[model samples]
Target: MECAAKGLAGEPCAGVAQRRCGSCGAVAYCSKDHQFVHWRFHKEECARLATQMSRIDVLSQFPFTFSVEPLALNHTLPSMRCLFLESIKVHLKGLWKPECICGPEIASVKDLSITAEWNMESSLCPCTEPENPVTRPLASWEDYYQWRSLPLHSPVAVLLHWPLTLYHCLQLSRIQTSRHDGHATLNIHYLGPEKELLQLAVFAELLALFPGVHLRIELVGPAVPRSRDGEVVNISSYAHCSVQNCGCRSSTAPEDLNSSAVTLKLWKGLYHERYSDIAKDSNPHLVLAPNAGVAAYPSWMPTIEMIREIGIPAIFTDFCEEAAHLASCCISYITGQPLGVPIQINPFRQPIAENNSALYIPCYSNCFVFGM
Candidate 1:
């Protein structure tokens, strides 16, 4: 870790940071002098970080088998990604490589032939709901896992964060489900999709989660493949599980399947660039951007302005608390209003932590969520 303190010339101190902040443990300093120099600025977020650190156990809870493994025992394992890769017997070389200081980007693993186990079917579709379908909001991963009858060994956590985060955003917006002939419809404009485009099928889990709701998600992003632009994928049924005797396979009858439970429309380019065309068709109930570095990207300004003018409930998630805090400030400045939903730790944040964070802060995909 590098020192968090600034030098006399207003540059970063070129000192090896070995001392951690006692209260929060979220940052480090090169020496006592540097620590004292950085205290004025660090004091503001120290308590908040302490509170987050206090809840580390809760934040780290996940159903994956890796969660129970002895990650802490491997002193040589640099980060969670290394442990995961090691567990899968994949070396951090050749086809598999680290993507950033955050660690290897799970999205870069595109060889389905090799990642078959990790890319297991959602097994959510064609399922029999519990005697009474869940109507109340799900508050945690454990709640969703129990409700869905998911095994603790399941590896879905790697990809389920996409839909789960969306579900959490809807809950934050308080968008009530209205039934019409025993079915509900939810329109969502999912902005800034990147790797999600390749794993769209995972989103079919939304059908099972929402039960009777038909989800129409418009994916708008620059990462959208040009050839796939304007393509509409209607997922009528959930992806089949590899397990032959799975409950969903046996319990669901052929006639019970809906024609289309989730419809994904792909649009190329930035949301603001094509939002006018998108709005012409249907107004979204909520706008969601997962891991959106709002303050870091200048492109988000137009979208923020449009969202403010249109007055739609928009939610954004970031990898760290500092990013979320900056994003919240950016939105507040753009909208000229207080946040509709204040910054908070997302209960459904990705279980794996990003190591090598400069601040030593706990960072994860969809770590902190806020809205304007």
Candidate 2:
């Protein structure tokens, strides 16, 4: 005999009395196919019964009454008494909430009162010009409702694979499930001219999915003129941002290589002094100098001819404009342990103090440390 749930060869285990559970014998299985293939019949029932059996299992450990069915199934059971007694109804929804269960709404932030009204004016970064810095402040504790346990929204879930579930939790936290009513509209502000407003709006919708972020879209200045092809012609014609473009997805290589790795060759240059211990085959990470002296080097300082001699596949990106494209390409390939290598001097600089943890490669001066 074997346990259907554990799939371990052993004595027959019964879950629902004579019925054995298809996945785990803690319950019942109608047939092998039903045990493995049919889920529509078992999912909700299993969750409900699992709650009951688990209660029975726990109570059996104590001197309390043997009957745990009421404890498990009752909406007003001991475990749920306080939650039900409370006047406020707590709800969960979105990626985090299943069925968008409605519950009490709670204020998430605190309120501070000013003794009196006063205003101060100061010239600040245009980014700091928003009239209201904080929106959606918590109103009161009356808004909160307690959750009983994890909600069942998906058909299949595993416990040991908690990382997958935890990531889901993080994403679900962003959904204001209680505000599912069509009336709840969020105002967004984008600091650009009218021409670029459409693109910014789409980006903001995506950003809203990030937790702890709220954006208010406001167009800062007049609209910029555009060419017939919908391209902005003048770069500096307006004050608010115009025609902003990024190399985040741009590539110089063929389209097929977008998903593959590219080899990197390390050329020796003024950065050579720092590479003394680093094997020519393995490019050394860089360190930036501080006010200690003139430390700025061209992005191509690492692209010397000697690097290509190593016979490793590599790409050449000397211009700052190309850094984003290069980084995107390399990162996409290195999703897991990758075979190829990439060398670039455009490593962002870390504060000098943070570099204390790593054996510091020498720098031309003292202000910054280049990271690999």
Candidate 3:
């Protein structure tokens, strides 16, 4: 771990952090002097961090096999990056590059839209309403798996976070789920989608989560390919395992495209740049940004301002408490108001820890969530 203290030049100290804070255990220092030097800034979050760390058991619970491993023991394992690569059967040598080092031109965007060639027929469809649908809140991955009748060993650990995070946001917002006429409709604006573009099928779980609610999610982000801009994906059925004897597939036929339960629209630009056009079609009831590095990205300022002006309830998740705190500060600064929703541990956060974090904090995808 790296020291949280700053050096004389106002940069993060380049010393090894072996001394962890006793109260919070979320930050570390190289020495007592450095700890004393950082106390002024760290004092603000010490108690909050301590409170969060106290509930480590609940926060760390997940159904994934790797969930049993302690995040603090990250040093013992080969790295989260290596684990992920092994899970997906990708080579570690030159095959994987977490971040793009080359210019944008070399990283050409591919068509991320779903097509008929995907062979949706081979996949199980959990489209029909269950004989006894789940009405209670699902508090954990195990809860969801039990409700959905999914085996614990299902290979959905990584991609399930997207839909689970969305569900958590909806729960935190307390959005009305009552049906009207025949079905209720919920519109969500998903900002800054990246890898999610390739795994949209996983979101079909929302159909099962909100039984009678029709979901329309508009994915707006720079990561959307230009070719797929304005493209619409209609998920008429929930995605299920293709295993022959899984026993969770629905017998009902797929619904017509026009009457799909979940619909996704893609936009290929920053949220603020295209919010006008997007809102003209359908105003969102809630906005979601998973792993949004609000403090690190200046472009988020415009989006924050727009969300505030429009008075939309927007939720954001960050990798760690420090990041969430910084993001909360950024949102407060941009909106000139205190956060409407305070940061808390996301129950459905990805079980895998992030390996690149410099601090001793338990960093994971969608680790902490807050709203404005």
Candidate 4:
């Protein structure tokens, strides 16, 4: 469209447009002075327009085509019968290992109902509002902290405050926003081997999908080599940090999607590889740990901490449900119960679940969160 700039000097800009508003791109300007004059009204309009554009962009990716009744208590893609139904059934659906978590009642893989409302839908945030309304570009953490002095929302709003689980936000591309009240904890169990691979895979996944997000890591647990091979430090080993030695935490965001970091040139790295022998694609969006050593996090700390620390944690362990019998037994550690509890509490109490036993969390591992 032509420039809409008009002024007392001569006339509205019927001239060829020279520039567009950098933020909204809705209006064109033939001259900078005209833009300045129009700024009084255009600024608010620009904010609204930008927000609307962002909403449209977000929805184009995640349409609410699949919303079932009696929503599943657990909210994650791994449990959401959409993307991972078959994957869980095939790779993870094994007989319940008696020692998996705990069970006053029977805890079966079948408890996670295949029939549940799994898709996301559009809705206004359920948080209380200040005189000023909240705008958008999907500020999850901001909303969580805003209205800090206000009373908490109901239990339901607290759970639904931020629904950016790896399964939902990263893999499934579904996210909805709401006001926050209380905190929700995430329990990321790094069960089985491949701990390093899984950790790197998670980091890389976050990097690939959410490069703008920050990743903060606290290295606990003793460093173990990837295998019996040699004494190469595991990626989880704080040795990977540019710093020297123990008690180290690194705050890193995924490499910017547009920027390139170091080249492994994997012969080995997560995104960069030195393996000239192997074919390579351009640097990937994911962060790959160099090839060689990968090990597990300490059982005490669990991998859940790492994921929650990645960005704003969203998914919680066991859907935060309380069993009729296990109320007193429930602990406040938040990452569900600690790694080595006898029974994997909350979700086990659920009649049907999308998560796994505490001992063996398949889809559960991916859906981690940070509590307020």
Candidate 5:
């Protein structure tokens, strides 16, 4: 009997299951799409079923041996992906829980997909800091790519000019999926004072989706007055954090109608250390390193070895492209592949070490998973 796999977006594929996985007939899928979506999820199951169906130790005799990491026995993955992350084992000390990286939550996927606005072959100059950085408008990817090609020096320049890329990445992570518990936590290194306005909008929309909210923020840029040890400010106390100024559609508010429930653990200086200490209370699922080096916190960059150890996917806006390498490593670890031409990169930079792995989306995204 053919093994008809169930599709995540819709109905089960029962059409004469023609594609056979591995040697035995125990696991089969009716279509390539069905097969792709089910692999990481079913790989372990396949091994068990294979033994019952055959006498040949199929995997044992094979040239490849994969030492799998321990996944949640609960199977509460955050997103639905075909090829999930698998890796060699390493350990770290953190109370954080793993989250599934997912695609855009907008009703229309077509709205977010890469558009043909730039020829992509056009010349780009080295990126530099804008004379006035705060009010810089976001650029389309084509223009961003074109500018990044120039002999760019500052990571700050990339952050100033490329808010759209960062915004899309935020959307792609779908970073705010609330658990059934009605609470969720996320971490974003506030890129700058102006960017805080945007972050407020993003967080407001995210918080409105759930009843109770726990926000952990690491503030950067010239916006917040610097304190050496950092400060914890309740966002509700800030006038700009109000629902009206936040520009969100969510109607949920505190009983008083004036106080926001959001909390901001704002800080600066030695972010990785500060962030780690802060994480003890509310473990954040994602980190926003949009600028990468300076405000994005480059010293905090972990080697590919460390990333495989943690088993968490990262979203990068390291306009300088270093974060891309780290992200590429995350993708490679999952697929057991070597780095190559990434699906995308800023113009005029060497490819990051982690390139061309299963972690990549076909265009303009890393760690993308589409679930119905």
Candidate 6:
């Protein structure tokens, strides 16, 4: 009893004589009054410890040794469950590991056999229009209806918050205001060259085959990349920031099928090889060049007329500050995705949320609807 009390006080309790309390074998007390005084803290622990001891049905099954000290009790259980589950998730290509699940038997990625490694030309971003003509042929309702009925194939909306994760924002727009058919209209805000855009474009092209499907992808900001010569490049030069390491986060709205489902996607779009250039640039909007094609900044990129046409009010900011805020504002909309960037506790690993109060998240079909 004396030894146990000393141990709880962080003192050496070994080699002390053992004295048992008459009331319960679950606890030890140095003296009669000490036992009575310590009863409050010990009472809860005593019941729990007693129940735990009673539940030990297969003590002899495992050859591990045991001790009766309360502090050491926690370490007796297996810790491998967490490691094993994490390993299984990595094997299954899952972004997030669920809590308290059994692990699947699979070798880690490091153990996998590989055939070959090749260096290839980066694919072009297909989401934005080509650079040869900066002026978008005005969107004609006649042509819009034709394409609208043709099939709204792979339409993705990417929202990203900057300075946290490398990649961000990639989503397929669904109908935002309508109910009959999915009448999602994608508006291009800003686009950087990233391979995911090409992949999305490929998906859109493939989805064009379905009936009553017309893809309307939009860029809300000036979707232009910088050229090799420090001028703005074409859309193809933009890297898919969602998958690439562009240090951004993304969000989207719910995809409602009953009404026009607005499926907002967030992913990384551009990762310039030159990060220092981004750091040195004074113009926040001109920080990094998209990984797409080379071209001059066309007149159509981020003009006041574009915002007015899109019905998005002008958002004025103080130079670089506004750009930083805009980056954060864009990311709040993401809800969920097949991919997840690693989360870290450090401030360096946290995404730059503009207001840090706005809630924008992407949604999955499997997730429970947040609101009716």
TM values, all candidates: 0.77, 0.15, 0.76, 0.22, 0.33, 0.19
C-alpha lDDT of residue 22 in model 2: 38
- Number of the predicted model whose lDDT against the real structure is largest: 1
- Candidate 5 C-alpha lDDT tens digits along 147-168: 3342222122211223344344
Off by over 4 Å in 2: 1-372
The whole-model lDDT of each prediction reads 0.72, 0.23, 0.72, 0.27, 0.36, 0.24
For residue 33, model 4's alpha carbon misses the true position, in angstroms, by 85
Clashing pairs in 5: 125-150, 126-150, 126-151, 328-354, 329-354
lDDT per residue (tens digit) for residues 1-372 in model 4: 455455532666646666778886556677887777778867766764454334323222211222212354564443343322232221122111111222112212223211111121111222111233324333332343242222222111212212223223222213322111221111121112222321221122222223223332211122222232111111111112112221222334233412311111111111111212122322111111111111121231323343324333222232221221122122224344432212222211112223322211112221222121
Any idea how many clashes model 4 has? Answer: 21
lDDT of 3 by residue, 226-284 (tens): 88889898776645433444443544435543333788999999999999999997688
Please, what's the RMSD in Å of model 2?
25.1
- Ranking, lDDT, top scorer first: 1, 3, 5, 4, 6, 2
Ranking according to TM-score, highest score first:
1, 3, 5, 4, 6, 2
TM-score of decoy 4: 0.22
Off by over 4 Å in 1: 5-15, 30-52, 62-65, 68-79, 85-132, 177-183, 244-260
Instruction: Give one clash count per candidate, in the order shown.
Output: 0, 36, 0, 21, 5, 80
Model 2: lowest-lDDT 10 consecutive positions: 112-121
Largest TM-score belongs to which candidate? 1
The sequence of per-residue lDDT tens digits that candidate 1 reaches over residues 243-354 is 6665544544335334337778889999999998988875799999998999999999999999998988899999888788889888889888989899998988877776
